[model samples]
Target chain A: MELTRHYLIRRFREYYHKAKIYEPIEFRMREWAFVPLKNFPDFVMVRHVSFSEMEELREFLISNVPAHVYFSSAYYLKPSAEMDEKGWTGADLIFDIDYDHLPTKSLESAKREVFKLLRILEKDFGIDEKEIEVCFSGNRGYHVHVYDERFRELGNMERREIVDYLTLRGFKLKGTQFDRVCKIIHRYVRDGKVNVDEKTGEILRSSLNEIRKGRLDLIPPEVREELIERCLKKLVVHVDPPVTADVKRLIRLPNSLHGKTGFRVVLIDLNDLESFNPYVDAVAFGDESVKVRLLKKVRVNFGGERYILERGRHSLPEYLAVFLMCRGVALYGH
Target chain B: MRRPFLPILPYLERYPFLKIGSKLFKFSKDEVLSNVEKARDFVEKVLEDKVEFDFKPIDFLCSNCGIREECEGYEGCSYNISSAEYHLKLSRAKKAVLNWLRCKVVVSNLDEFLRRRFAVKLARLYRDLILKECDDFILFMADDFGLNHEGFSIHVADYLKYAVRMKSDDWKLVNRFLSKGYVDLSRNEFVRLMEKVIKEILMEKVQINLNVRLKVDFKRKELERLPLKVECFPECMKSILSDLNEGKNVPHTGRFAIASFLINIGYDVENVVDVFRNAPDFDEDKTRYQVEHIAGLRGKGERYVAPSCETMKSWGLCVWSCEVDHPIKFYRRCLSGGDKGKRSSKRKGDSQDYA
Candidate 1:
């Protein structure tokens, strides 16, 4: 697999200005880090830039086009050269819903998992939808950012508790204390009366009992247990553990180009997530054809289209060629 | 020129029991703001002079301290200035602030626009003055509200309804505090703001009150009480009672479950106390008070419910599938003269309930 440096450099110069870098409200008060070059691979940290100097930072990106760009989730007061020296401020609670953590391998399955987590965050924790920001990671997953101020102040232990609640870990089936009567057959119970047999005068157990003809003399004892088991099943939402637990961890910048996928890190509308196809929506390049040489036979399924390539020169769409080159499976041909 | 402690005055009059030390104080918005200002001045004064509260214990007063019985020279004497003088002062300050919040402070006299405007200014002042030094307190308060625990203590939610007769009445205000955006207050923003300010002003000693006492043991004695039937008890309850009867140590959850279970089944506080008398570490007064608290005869007048089947399962105390949803349901059947020997027959056709 080969990738031409000149092609990447030229592409970065052309489209780097258009790339969007997510900045905290206090941008200057954060520690920024970036991969200077693909060959170097090491992330050079301890960089700081004010809002006014964003243009200079953009120009630097145009010149170098770092392999990856990241700003600390944390807002620091000192933001020194060493991490320990920096005074910690609060951060946005970001959940990395990667495909690997999901029960199924498909992106569709990952989306379902992400939605389940979103539901738990909303219904259980009462976090508002507007406070949550969803971003496609431009590779293999989604990044959900909860910008709610309440979550920002949560420590690692508290954040782990949220993860525990989501995953249903440490959830005891017998410990659930509900003051209200169980809802399962309560709907059928009208005016404090259960359907009863007239002749023998026995109270019939309603919908919750399988005994259609037999009289339910008492409230079923297992009604609460059954409801709890169902609740436990619904509560088990899979999430990438490390991502939620790390309060100070840096995340992929939203709307910025992912160096590995050659696709833009796209911001998704929570209401429109069902229709959001990352490959189609996040293509940063035009459809003009470009010549590329595949180092090996490559089969790519992107957007709605699929392509099979042999180890030879082929004229492909500009976006597909760039994607292949970025993936390091093809080279720019003269 | 200031609002006449309008919102909180009624609350203080209603709940005379909400005393901050010797004084049953009526705390207002102005009082809270003024306290913040005072605490700021105190912080600066103490920081400048380095006049710190000494945590060291004085050896002579160890016998007279209220907590000396439990202290046993192991957890150190509680006779220090921090606990004696400053701790009381802190507890009072905390109660004042908590009472201020407990009384919903929306004013009819002030203009709606001015109210929000003043609220924003106050929120910002609290954020700047209090948040920097007392972040841990704020975090603790948040957790204290958010997490549910098995105990006979007053939760933040309980305090929110300081004078409210019913949970539903207080829940209406809580729902408003948490519901969709209230003009300038965007969803739970107000709650978060109030929590931070309250935490900053509140002293750590009074943040959680777990002390329980029996106020009406006579009234409790008049109520019809039943003998605890161990044979008919749920597995979890039976296990806890067995542990206590054998003078074996049980966890707090177990104690809570047992206390809640016995009380819910119409057993009086004294009977419940007798059940725990054999426990190795049982204290008669403490056990009686805790039992009274769980029986809803003391403290907040709210009886503790037995931990649900799910809670027992989580605690790893749920041993058998009794096919009952709640421990209370099992106990209710036994207490109501339902056939205990014929209980197994009730489980025969209940496939869907088990499913």
Candidate 2:
């Protein structure tokens, strides 16, 4: 009999019971094919049970394998409400530990940091070197396998207590704690003792500083407020000087109320068209032809957009005003 | 023994004919003037001042005369005697003046016209022959003047050979016309043909020589010193570099073979060279060897030997060596029976697609 069957049951209970001792309700074991573990036993058998009876199963597995082992829940847990309804699956036991996610840029330095973390686990947490196995999960993470068999018959509550004890003793869940641990490992790897080049050294140092300052998370509230002020100043630079006051007032108003009631109005002079038309040889008939040609050229270069053309009267001042308005709209509108 | 009065004799002879013709036709002064004007106009326009007049009417008549010993055509005839006697009677200064005057007007005009239309020296020779009035010399001058000129006739054979080599229809036509002399060639006609042939040959020679020189320069200056960064053993790079330096002659011959091969496969020379230039770590010797070998293979009706991975690895230094997405992948395909024929066929297809 291989150790993983008993070891797996103990690990399952440790997370569930949140205690080191309990009574068993039921226990059943099934023979499985021999799947070679990288750093553990050659074969693995599995035990199945209800959540209530998980403690005794843990006790039973624990006694069989006294070697140090790693454990996790068989299902992923998320903070969202929609995820809570779905019961956990056994696949969650395979937590991915990505060494590359270390805040450093140099791959070699990052890998060394991962080794340092593993060394801590081996020496401080009493994890067995022989029982540990590393796997590339084909993405960003690595799967560290521990096949030590112990507390195989422990009840769920008892197993949970052991996990609680370990948690308190500094073993972390997958969040900020995990992120910190990864950073520490990466730091040791990036120490100047390695044969890394100067460029890699600079990148590693910069990345470490970023992690330390927690800049990886969202920008702080104060920073966000400053950014908004900067954006307003940029907008002010682009606005016309004549409309600067109105634009500033518009910018100060909230978006919802401003959209409901327009805040800024632009008035353009339209008297130039009277003299301009004669210079351009644009009579009423020729006006249409010139307009068509101009529109075609515009379409060729700038494409067309839908706009409401407000034609007041056929007077020169009205035409000039309309032309100015069209120019403004073409310059600024979508 | 008396002065021959040659000017008055010609006038007298012409007067009798003029009088008889006027009587027979009963032409008025207006009609006569019109007739003279019309004749002069026709002569000026049609002949372009190139016609010759017969001054020795007695000699002309005697040459056509049937009597033996008295006719110019007869051996030791009286025509020669009359010509000698006529020549002896003229003052030396008068004869010199007449010859000088003829040379200035007739000979100079013919020479200028021939020079403009034909070649330089031949026109000068034609002028000389006209001035000398040596009929025997004129025929020889004509033979040696244009396309049939003594030294230039060899170009006809050379052009024929070149046409056969190039397999061009225009060149073939030129070759055929020149070799057989089938076209009716006057001095001017021959000169035009010769000029055309010379121009074409000069142009083609210039183009080919430029192409060859550029290809050689590219191989020597640019392609040979490619920056090849091999992640493999340093020995491989060393050996490759050695092989390239040792087989340096390959690019020279290879340029010709490769250009010919590309042209045969319907690629322009520039495109082929450009493709070769941009190919990564392209082994000039190997590429040249392969192209030449493949062309030979094609000639022999044998299958083209696809390049190996090593060959392609060398080729992959330049970006445009092959069409595969990756250099390694291209090498793999080349190793795994990638069709040389298909690649060439694809190039033809691509050219058509672009067109």
Candidate 3:
């Protein structure tokens, strides 16, 4: 099943609560390294999700597990521990997604669908593709992993934004969940004033066929361009404010503490929400404004004086926490 | 016998000749003798007494005698007594005169005659000695006198001309002297000189036999006549012929040449033996075989076919160069009498021609 924002949030809460109460989530600073796990059964087996309910279970496994998770066809899969042991870092990861799979195939159909989802996370939710790595699992699935530094301090709401972003993109579970994901993405576009022309509508009707037949290029360039532009415009205006607000809001949670200073203070303003959604042509400006307002409010309340509003979903929280810690707010205690 | 005038008596005895000549001429004997003695002594001393005893025998003449007037032309003459030694000296004087006469008579026309007869010989001997004992001398002269080989040769020739200018009829006696001191020539040099003389004599218009004894102690055939033409066939062929004549192994050159000659005569190689025997120099079967082999005409049998024009072409010779009209002619004309089926059937057909 397509993971709902509620389900993703629940999983994140579980992990966050567990980390807060039971275990001191060991913070290890590491540089990036990628070791490709292609042709390995371990990588293949990790992506196998059979039932619709498994979506929740998969999200939980990905978010909570401290182990390195790799998409099947990902060119690299080095863990932090691997980097630590080797004492070397700095490698690029090249993921080969299996577009033959249904979920991935859906994502490829109507460039707007995937673009739309990416726009929600990136522009609306302030998530970057860099922070969230994605690949098509070699079998019949797509794998999205949030490897952003913000994930260490991720609360329920920030995790929800990631799921909502993926779901909006075209990720779906088995059978009925695919229809739900499609409906949700369709509704999101409709509400956001995303324009779908007659040709694009026709293409959408035949999208599954095109994807199944492995002819994703069948969509004309003009149509793909229009959809991507429109979706990007929508996301650019809609997602940033909310993502910023949500990041600020999540920082107020007891678990989201500054490591140095014991104080909990937010420094960003919701009035600056319009500044975050700088794209004037975006179709989902209202949604972006709302997100920005929420993020600004959270920043003002929880982000301390030293916090600087950096670009991207993953870094905003880390930067805020670091800023608060620099201002003498101890993250562990507060 | 008074002790008186003892010194005066000795002086008087010492001056006896002077006293006698002075008294005979009249006047105070002592004064006259002194004046006459001074004049005579001055005359004798100036005339010939100045001749050193070490003067050569050729310069000898009786200087104290009244023969001084006749010795006008005999100054430094070998007959001069002052130049000669005593009793043993007289013998030496006689020997010196004889030697001088011999040198005069022997060496007068000696150089001219010997040069006319053995100029080249002497020149060659001189050159050989210059080359042998005088290698350092030759090198020094070549460097110091700026002489190249030609210049050195010219210098040697000039020396020879000078040496041979001496008049000597008896070469043996002249050679004896030359052996002692003059030439310094070695035996090899003498032989070379002889060879040069022989060569020169050969070049002369006069008929002469070169039957000289060689220094190498080997018997040499007398060269009785000039303009001998030496035949030089290929060494291999000559060896073959020599071997055949001497009943020794015949060489391949003779065999190959004879075989090739037979083939060139338009005879099939099968008839090589017959053709070889017909060759002008052929005398026996062995000689014939050798000739045939040398001619490259040896065959397996009488009926054996010669190689075709094409076969010859394949062997890197032009087909047109072969005598046969066609390749098959060798088999049909040459080997017809042999076993009919002995050759391959393929060779009997046009296929062999194509191949």
Candidate 4:
């Protein structure tokens, strides 16, 4: 059994009828896009549409029942028009932390990166947490957006430089940032943590200031790159740079359903993200019985219940069935 | 035309590269050149190889201006601009003598060229002054740049723009100096960077009004026209071209990348512009301007390379998980190896749809 397109559409329509779409700040200026239930699993976007009011958008979503909904990170004068004519004003600075790009491929790792990114932004860039919006991307990531007015006007090069800073792409031992790195290595050396050769060991052990003008270069290229890589693993964040750089990118709208998991793209407060469980909190369906035949053995602890499903037809909770069906692991049963 | 006695003439005769902010006394170039004696005399010092970089740029420390080593920080920034101004005139005179030393033509054999590298000392002199100009003299240079000296830092955006032409890898924001939305600079570091910026600005601005032809080696145009092996074109470019061929609305960054890449690879403006015609929003006027600008034929004359693979990926424009880290290398690898071209050409349509 496979997930039928009709059942998926019906479920999506049901969710949209009650789903409260979190409209972007400048709702009128943003170009909206949606992947309709045209071809299942493979979403082809039909974009260059704009709405004047939130109510109109809500009505369209409820009736049309798009599989995935999105709004432009940018605000344009003629958002509904062709690309050239759509006069771009400014855009929200978005840092999309997909799990695929992180040091570890897990939602928790992505969340930790979110915290790391925020800390870096606050300490280095002087951005306050209040001005940023953090949202669970409903699949395997989080989208942290900077909506401060000054950041809106930053062009591609400036944005890319900021990305370079976060990723520590061009970091060399010369600045205040590297001074901190030097001091850390110095402390580690003094404390008998890291071993080194005589010449390099002497430089590290001598003084922090000496290490600043130090012979880190005396270390081999593999060792130096490995050290940088380790630093990257610790301090650098793996934000999808293109997402931040693309001023007119269409991001997943908050409070909308993800086509892959039938999970809500829920917004979370910055200070209150530690307790969020996407499997439980982001679940949009409840415990009503629904027939689904598993195409493969699935093991997932979803919504606080462990379901070890084998390849066969089974009557499962509506939430589990929808999750499995949306995941393309299960289908509408006979 | 009557020649006017310009108040800034003395200043100009000193530091030819120094910018004076006044149109108070307007004079024509013809009127200035009407006195051919002054022009010849001005140009002669350069011809004789008399311009030397020495104590002239640094003697502004003053007889009793009270600029101690400790005072070199922001505390000493206020040490008598008037006192320094007069001393600055002397330095300007020396710089103007050096700066306007514009046209001493030298034709030499390679051994002679190597032996008589007269510019080496002048360059080292500038570099040393850049490093050691920690006192009021360097502060005057910063003032000329019109940098905001409020709390000893410039905004990140303000500084990153100029950081492009910086010579050292140290000037990169990722290296250090970025903090709290501003790029913090120590006084010496600030002076060093401004000196580098001044060097570039001088090179860009100090074009002589006179045009005298001199023999120089020029590459023939025919050599650049040899067509690239068509099959060796990278997949990412083909993907972008295919999108444009179907009249897709490519983003502005994508357009810039493709245009700059093509121009760098010796594609002419007309052919480049033609390639962009398949764009849905293509306006010939806009396209030409954009194409010519990237080709470095107009506006700043600063040619751009196609962005690195990292940058291309950041723009979401990478169509392949290519082995090489640069698009140019991708093409080069195809040229050198020739195996990747065929295999990648048979790629599924789905992966090629990067737009």
List, residue by residue over B1-355, the lDDT tens digit for candidate 2: 2223332222223221212222222333333333233333322322243433333322222324455343332123333235555554334323333322222222223322221222223233323323332322222223322223333232332222222223222332221222221222344333334344333321221111110111111112221122222321122222333444454433332343334433343343344444455444566665555554444433222223222223334343221223443333332334345454126323322444334
Candidate 4, residue B102: the lDDT equals: 40
Scored by DockQ, the top model is 4
Encode model 4's per-residue lDDT on B93-131: one tens digit a residue: 544444343422111111222212323323334556556
For candidate 2, the per-residue lDDT at B233 reads 12
The RMSD of every model to the true structure, in order and in angstroms, is 20.1, 43.1, 54.1, 10.9
**Stretch of 10 with least lDDT, candidate 4 chain B:** B103-112
Against the true structure, candidate 4 has what lDDT?
Answer: 0.68
Model 3 root mean square deviation, Cα atoms: 54.1
lDDT (Cα atoms) of all candidates against the true structure: 0.56, 0.29, 0.30, 0.68
Sort order, lDDT high to low: 4, 1, 3, 2
Evaluate model 1 with DockQ and give the value: 0.01
Clashing residue pairs, candidate 4?
Answer: A242-B314, B14-B92, B14-B93, B15-B92
lDDT of 2: 0.29
After superposition, candidate 1 runs with Cα above 4 Å error: A1-3, A38-52, A174-234, B1-355
TM-score of chain A of 4: 0.89
Interface RMSD of each: 11.1, 47.5, 63.4, 2.6
Each model's DockQ score = 0.01, 0.00, 0.00, 0.30
Per-candidate clashes, comma-separated: 19, 46, 79, 4
Best by lDDT: 4
Best by TM-score: 4
Estimate the TM-score of every prediction: 0.47, 0.15, 0.14, 0.62
Off by over 4 Å in 2: A1-334, B1-140, B145-188, B193-349, B353-355
